[model samples]
Target: MLRLASLKFGRLFRYGKLLFAASLLVVMLLNTHSLFSSFQRNELTDRRFLSLNKCPACFGSSWCRKFMNGQLSFEGWGRLRLLDFFNVKNVHFAQYGEPREGSRRVVLKRLGSNHELSELDQRICKRATGRPRCDLVQAMYKTDFARLNGDVRLLTPDVVEGWSDLVHCPSQRLLDRLVRRYAETKDSGSFLLRNLKDTERMQLLLTLAFNPEPLVLQSFPSDEGWPFAKYLGACGRMVAVNYVGEELWSYFNAPWEKRVDLAWQLMEIAEQLTNNDFEFALYLLDVSFDNFAVGPRDGKVIIVDAENVLVADKKN
Candidate 1:
């Protein structure tokens, strides 16, 4: 009886040992799986960052710069629309008369796109139920510059648009004179007015709001052929094109979510612009805006004179 009891106890002990070994092996496998999963996630994040931070210039190539440098400027009503948001729609380019350097002077006036309205269109707009200035042509070309110097009699939309026709379609001599003045003054108040358009302000505001982590994927500017290539964020892209057309839409495969992101970013930038808190605004203006791009990474809708997008505190 004692021998049988001894054998049974030994068997029970052996079985318990086997069970313990199996549990330990399972625990080790689970730990290994968890570790591998964490490693994979980290690797993916690092790759994303690297791509975002890559230099745009390194990728833009020489051909791209050629494409962007020679785009045609807007004309006529298109030019008026371009100047409207900044309240400079009434600005008319006129010649000051015979001068030592040139013949004509560039002046600001109020003008609408439809200044060429047929007599019927003008008559219908006149009868419309708004202020006397509510003519369709007037509404289209009118801008508020009351803050600058109050409305000048010469600032009517009709006058301004008419001026555009003369200025844009100027005789070679007139155009040459205006160009000389612009060259001399560098388009400051003497040439281009100090006023900024609303869209421009909005772009600056968005740039200021951006504060990405110091990861590789954060956007930064690059050294492209143009001077404006250096202000991109890590995820920023630079696309050089001569014309402002639908090409911007082609680059991103038209992702709806991406478009929404771009819009949100622009609004954020605009808010910062109005407030003029420009830690990042200057950089964006110098690169993104000057090239006339709307968003950071290869955006369309470029805003000219972006270098002027400095904070009041930082203005030199």
Candidate 2:
């Protein structure tokens, strides 16, 4: 009798434990508002730290000099993207700019970058300057910036579908400028923008928010020849073709949920863009909020600048 009573008690104890765990999960779900409130108040401050410790700069001048010298710039290859929680390719788009000294081909910009671990920037001390560049770069890649928070609240499906121009058309002035700029490329096969109506134009812009590869693939010419090759040879890609917005960094100032969505969306697009993709290796690494904008209807994002795109592989 005593053994049977003990067995029953053990069953009851297990049931109690399971009930406690379920109760804890519900509490956590309910406390999400408090957690989000706490994160914004403390973690997402205006302060931008270079890092928690000394690190080498990946996108800094040391790597850019390699690019200018016409060498493989693997240092600038993997950039941090929070959404996927991994580093991905960041091909610096330098086509159509100043020709590299020795090579006839154009290279991406040689922008100087200091990770900005400035005094008054934070409580953490400045990083030691003597660390090996490789170690610093690797450390920077490994660090996690996001403070633990609740899952993101995605934009509604109805709103995603509402990214249409039936409600609102893009600015005529902007369209004219974008069209004129594209016409300057004189890319014979790519003048389709001239015939597209405002709705079609808006649709193209909206589609860019998801991925720019389809447009890039479509821009490739049919008949193999010099005119199309020369145009691409000098500057790499047709810049200003896809750029629709002016500033996306401003979205960071919005509420935490909005900020998460904007950053996630941008990186999500970037993750899909293959730098060394296609028959001619296409690298579209030109990234800036200035090259993007929002739809007038549902405020869906768009990328404007395609100039930094590089297409390699064809013997010229």
Candidate 3:
């Protein structure tokens, strides 16, 4: 009986050792994979920066030049940390301008996740060339801007009828107003179009159609009393805006009076946006605490995320 018990005990010990080894191996493999992924991501980001610098149709040319030249810098992309794997949005933080010129912290956003951007590219390619595998530059050159403009006009009236996926507005008058304002301000749009290749111009316009945040910011600039983040500039798909403050979600636990004030401010903003003297009524379709922030000094509510805003032509 003693010998049998010893044999069983010896078997159990060996099994436990094997399990421990297997668990350790899994952990090591996971770490190795994570490290490799981080390296790949960094490499990819570097490549994108290089491409942006070389592209003629760069958005916010001055800002892009500064970023590529190291006047503006950010932490290199690496996702080795477990928490980083959950960051689905292509957003980053960086310091803008030179220290001597009053550098400020800014938030950079790609306006969409990697997956979403990839899908957009595919759609654009297919529409331009009838094939998802076509060259993006060549496809852009082939895209008919006149046709796109016509579609934009048609979609404008559809916004009120709930048929448009572009800007939520009836009549193209609001879009025209924004474009005129942007052009009058001598913003990057005019410079970008001047002597630009048809391919580059098409690329720029298509990107705007996909995401109108740039247009919105330029038209309703924070300096002009718009309760939106101050636009710094953009490079390729990424846009830079001044970091307003911590998200409104972070202020939920503040004093009751402070919370009440914030609530009142938000309601006032809503009313102003809907009933402003302007010909258009701007409606925020997706409202969440995460999309707004309180000014660090003024405590004013600002819309940090202006992606899903809808502009409706009140006259129409």
TM-score per candidate, in order? 0.19, 0.24, 0.73
Best by TM-score: 3
Q: Name model 1 segments beyond 4 Å from true.
A: 1-181, 184-253, 269-316
Displacement of the residue 305 alpha carbon in candidate 3, Å: 0.8
- Tens-digit lDDT track of model 1 for 1-316: 9999999999999999999789866765667765454334322123221222322201112222221232212233333322343443222222222234543222222112224223323433344433443444233222221121212211122322222222212233322222222211223122112232332221111122121111001111122122122221111112122222232334356578767765565565465544442222222434332234343445534332232233222321
lDDT of 2 by residue, 215-280 (tens): 332354312211111112111111112222335766666788866777776665554343323333
In angstroms, how far off is 132's CA in candidate 3?
Answer: 2.3
Q: What is the C-alpha lDDT of each candidate?
A: 0.30, 0.34, 0.63
Give the total clashing residue pairs for model 1. 40
Whichever of 2 and 3 has more TM-score, that candidate is 3
Candidate 1 TM-score, true structure as reference: 0.19
Model 2 TM-score relative to the real fold = 0.24
Worst lDDT run of 10 residues, candidate 2, spans 233-242
